[model samples]
Target: MFEEDYKRRFVFGSDYGTSDYKYGPITLGERPAVIENRGYLPERSMVSKILGVEKDIVVGKDVAYFLESGADLSSRMIYPMRDGVVAKSDPTAWRVIKELTKFSLEEFKPSGFGFKGYYIVASLSAIAPRYMYENLINIYDEISRETGLIHASTIIPQPLAVAIAHKELSCVVVESGHGNTQVAPISRAPIRDAIVALNRGGSEANAITAEVLKDSGYGDLAKEESLVRRVKENLGLLPLNLDEAINYAKRNPEHVRAIYQVPGTRIKIDLAEYSWTRFLIGEYVFDPNHEIFQSYFKRGMPRPSDTRVGDITFYGMLDMAETIIRAVERCPVELQPHLYSHIILSGGNFMWRPVSTMKGIAVDSQTKLQHMLRDKGLENVNVRLSPEPQYAVWRGCIVYGYAIPANYRWEWEKMEGWVYHTK
Candidate 1:
């Protein structure tokens, strides 16, 4: 009991995002350290000969070294949370997740004062299954056994973490990351039954951007996913009206035309006549049902299909507006209006900025969501982007860790409070 009391002083937050793992103790001010949520399992020969290390897995920045060693990246690299959830049977994915957790804790493990462990608050997908939670708990327990890195831990939904960061007890959180989008309604506590998961996000935007690249004669460059993403970030435009935006681009092709130089390379891509297709990238994310996107699907691009991942049915073709409505309607009617009024957008996917030069033509995520809601008869809707969408979950973890009472025991039914892993 005394040891558990001592552990409360060092609180840590870990956000297991699809693209990156954001983690650090509460002392890590404002933001947490981010590492790509990936790992590389070094070949047995290399581990024994070159590195002289017995560890089988390499994580975070070290993964890049293995990549540079000319290993077949496809076989060696592992992205555990690529789809935001790991299956029970996938040992490789589980290993990556375990290594990531260990890597994070070790980085900040204080050396002095006979450190006991850390009180950790970890965030996961809102629709994560019981098995995923169990898997994570087991992983943390293993780390504790090996290094005494965890005193206790608790897991909360990513959307709930975002809500906690903003002290929004009653708001709808639309968190879109690289792999998927989660729309969750909260009224003090998250309405788990009402949560909606979408199999679309920034990655989908990247896909459309790649398609645009192929159409613009940069077919070879499109194969490089990272390069295609950079081009998309630099050139993609969210249109106020998709049809009008395309027509405007056609009329003033010179204004829309752009040349993007790869940051560290001399290669420059000139989207001359094909610049108009840039709007399609953003449009596809909000509403893949748009007629324009059909061409890409027909031309071999994989269509986003509805999938069921452990009780949560992810809608692939639903637009942002319809998704919000679908999720909100599941809650009590009395709470629906309040949720609409405080619609909070949180995630990397919503961190888009309006191109000021484009003026009336360009739109930011908030404006786009508002317009979509209004079209669906949602009047006086207030959709706002999270102040720090990318770090909101991490921040919430910090706050949750600090606020939740150390004595409060975990209740499976409520799914809140600290779960004491080490006595």
Candidate 2:
């Protein structure tokens, strides 16, 4: 009783996503605290001396201040995960991950009596290698030894965490983040052999938005990725059909016209005459191989290329519908319908809203996915976005850590259960 109660009070969850890190204790309730999953290594200078900055690396919210202070940010800043996987040789990436972990644990470290350490449940991308698991666990172990802030720790795949949080024991989870998308089928546990991944994601959409900005005479703003991404989230549209939406926008330009004023700034972007290009952003994200995109390619937009990382190949050109089909078909033939019927889209990339006036021309991600799947001849398909998609993985981690017993030791073959930091 005491052990379970202790866990209930101190179960901690950490989601190491590509763009942001979600972390907190189980008590965080609905959403975990988030910080950009990045780190800045400050260059030694007089300016650094004046700011009273002593640490070699900066993580969490203070990183923004350090970033704004320098122009050499591209060289100094590091994003640990690329397409959801981190390379072992990149010491900078490891440093960022380690610092972020330590910072998060320390931020919420309990000082009360009878508090031993947190039972941490951290999630990684589905395609992460054994070495990543080992490396991460080693970090936790080291942190536990030094700070005594971790009772035990374990790692689970992001898709499984999504499935667990969504309470879908037998379904497909299509997790899309900034750099890549993953389609993994789950039947209690993740079906490792059935996982399918795409090299396309939100970044691809941002790329198109940048091109559109250039074409719309906002050429100067096109160079700023953050600004372009903001322009995209505000002005982008997910069309039911690219051709149909473009035709409607061209005929009734006022209906789709969008202008986004950058927050806390004098800058405002108006995609006036080029409003028809809005559909291209979402269309390209879902299906980049459409014939119309060839012109963009010719105009110097980089194609999302197929890249092989470790033993997996992330298909860049596969349409969302085909990607789901490929992943579901890899599972047991009898289970295909079960997986198809309960498709769950989980991630920030799927966070889209429909315009009521546009009606049939524009739609939310869920409706767009259903249309695409229907076109692919998959009947009785029901697609829904994961509730609180941004924090689903972290919430799942909290639940997982709370349930697993302290006595069931961590095992390499099963890849579940706790690695006891203190006996």
Candidate 3:
């Protein structure tokens, strides 16, 4: 009975990404439940007053219902990790994170005898400050006190989690999410000093997509962030050479022209004469320094600015090749080769597919990176996407949770092990 109960103790892995929170108990096997990382705090309503719904914060899928109710979503809705880091002063963002944690834990909270709280491993941005870590720990402690929902919890960097997931101890992990991208060199452990962060990511791609929409006479729909993102994912194409690709696209407009229909809506977007510009979206992601992007900057698109957040510096206009080279060079010369050879691209931003119709012209992320490296005289570089880029961090969390000794206690200095919560 003790053994059975021990086996039943909840073990969860949570990847707290800027765009979505991917979480599940390790027992669920491979996949985890993905929910928008945003939360909605509903205003006090007559029904709530009568029902005594004190906790107005709603997280995950339920926020959709609140949004549909037309209850001032812009003011009420809160995205915790808007830029991969939440300020200590932001209570609403912290509340959303806390609610997200509670929702996930309660979802798989088992029912039976000898039930202890869950052992969870949460992944965060590589550039997250020490204060952010402390805040999360305090939040978890509160959750534990309110509901006994956590036995113990620890945090890991998202890129490190990606390395753990792929079992690549000595590789450069480039984790590109919606808000930003982190390039971390891991040799058994993350090389903290060598990590590079980029201010640009998927959202930047969406920005360019919005520009393309406006150019294509869809100026009204350009403001629809979700629609613009969908159009980007469906129609965007990364090319071998931006200039050549654009010229080819201009010459052969019929081949590149395509239309994307927004799901669950009657809206359809046609690239039309602007079809060639599709390549610009993907090109901008890899090399934002391209002169073509200058037009958008002139037109008032917020150019990705170099900013220092926490202990890390996020470069605004750095190309992927330069970013990788810069990060790897910061490490020991002997270890740099190994790091360069095994480049692990993991994240939603790297999720690119080949355009079957545009086979010769279209290149996936790996191919693009490989070509970029080759151009810089780097050879034998093996760049590949994580098996499940979206789930890699979560999987790594699970593996980490299982491997960590039960008796281990949280240490502030090392930032590992379990944080014991006391009421």
Candidate 4:
């Protein structure tokens, strides 16, 4: 049997990227809140638009909503995690956490039964460094002192938790949230090889796409940051057929291109006019002429093989591939095959097929010296792209509380802090 008593836990995951702070709550077995219009009410509201229930039930409460008061508050809720590190390094973030805990209890309606415990599922990345671990503990302790809710601990790595939730082992986990593209090799039990790229993610791509569109000088349309993001999501990759794409950019700039429209603002562009800029943006991944490839190819150029596609020319693709390969190279030799077998990918950038498609080359480039060994046709080298790449980290953290064994609770508390214990 399991602990069956109703215990209110505040489950939250955050993507504190370079530009934004996003958070949401998670529930283990029951609805946590009766979500209302832009705010949650203690009392049940109308029927759930999706679940067809009389009360609008949300499985987990949201810290963003609580901090922003469901968009009702004037002060913006800011996430302090940046580059997979908490930026504030101060205690304010903890205050927000405590408030979120209070809100979660309100939503879950923990009985007049005195508060039993408060738990949180934080990112394993948050615990990677010793200093980060200590800061997190400080934050947690502060929250406990303010809120008085007891019982708290952190679970496994974010990617590992997600793997547990998906019941997927021997897979690649990628989380591209705000700042970094985090890759982890996951088996059914734990993470094997974890690698993170500092300068690659959705935000960078968004900026590149936006700048490209702006340089094209069409209308104010596609140049808008929001519009660029949408367009990049929709049709941002370099065309498989460069000639065809070039023609498309030239002749039908309006249809092939995009524009953004707000209530009062709008912009459009004829991408053909800014083809050079587009190509520059594409170089972030597909630049075959990059220093590394150019050096290698120049040394010994081979005639095009029938099975091989032409060498990649997109700069972005090349960088992504090279980075992954480099990281793979940095992995211990004994763990290489195991890590490759469990390539788990997450991140908003991974949403782009062009980015994911280069994984083989990226891995291959680094292990090129082991060409014979790699070419031996290892079928187990798999790249597992998470279904919802953006939410994986947060969702994983939410379930960590349930997935990990309880034996490590002390370490978790020492690193994170005691949960909010209300006397």
Q: Against the true structure, whose lDDT is highest?
A: 2
Per-candidate alpha-carbon RMSD to the true structure: 2.0, 1.4, 2.2, 11.5
User: Which tens-of-lDDT digit does each residue in 1-423 have in candidate 4?
Assistant: 133232224444433333333344565332122221122222233433343444321122442232322333323333334445543454544444334434544444345665554565555442245565555556556656655443454534555655655656644455555444545555454433344343345555565566555455633544344456665665455433334445555665554443334335443344554543343333333233334334323444321111211221112332444444545555556766776665555655555444243232222211321232244444455555666655666566655654444334445534432233333
Clashes of each: 0, 0, 0, 44
Error of 4 at 62 (Å): 13
Model 3, range 105-135, lDDT digits (tens) per residue? 9998888786668888899999998988999
The TM-scores, one per candidate, come to 0.95, 0.97, 0.95, 0.60
Query: Model 1: how far is 75 from its true place, Å?
Result: 1.5
Error of 2 at 262 (Å): 1.1
Q: What Cα-based lDDT does every candidate model obtain? A: 0.87, 0.89, 0.87, 0.45
Write the residue-wise lDDT of candidate 1 on 1-423 in tens digits.
664456456889999988889999987899999998888887777545776766689998877666644337667777787657877889989999989999999999898886778999999998788888888888888888899999889998899899999889999999999889999999988898999989998889999998888888889888765687788889888887799889989998988888899877899999888999988878888899988888889999989989998789999999989999999999999999999999999988886778777776778989999998999898979998998899999999988888777898888888878877777
Q: Which scores higher on TM-score, 2 or 4?
A: 2
Write the number of the candidate with greater lDDT, choosing between 1 and 2: 2
Model 1 compared with the native: what TM-score?
0.95
Identify the runs in model 2 with alpha carbons over 4 angstroms from their true place.
68-70
Error of 1 at 257 (Å): 2.5
Name the best candidate (by TM-score). Answer: 2
Instruction: Name model 4 segments beyond 4 Å from true.
Output: 1-25, 28-79, 88-115, 124-128, 148-150, 187-196, 218-235, 238-255, 263-318, 329-338, 353-381, 412-423
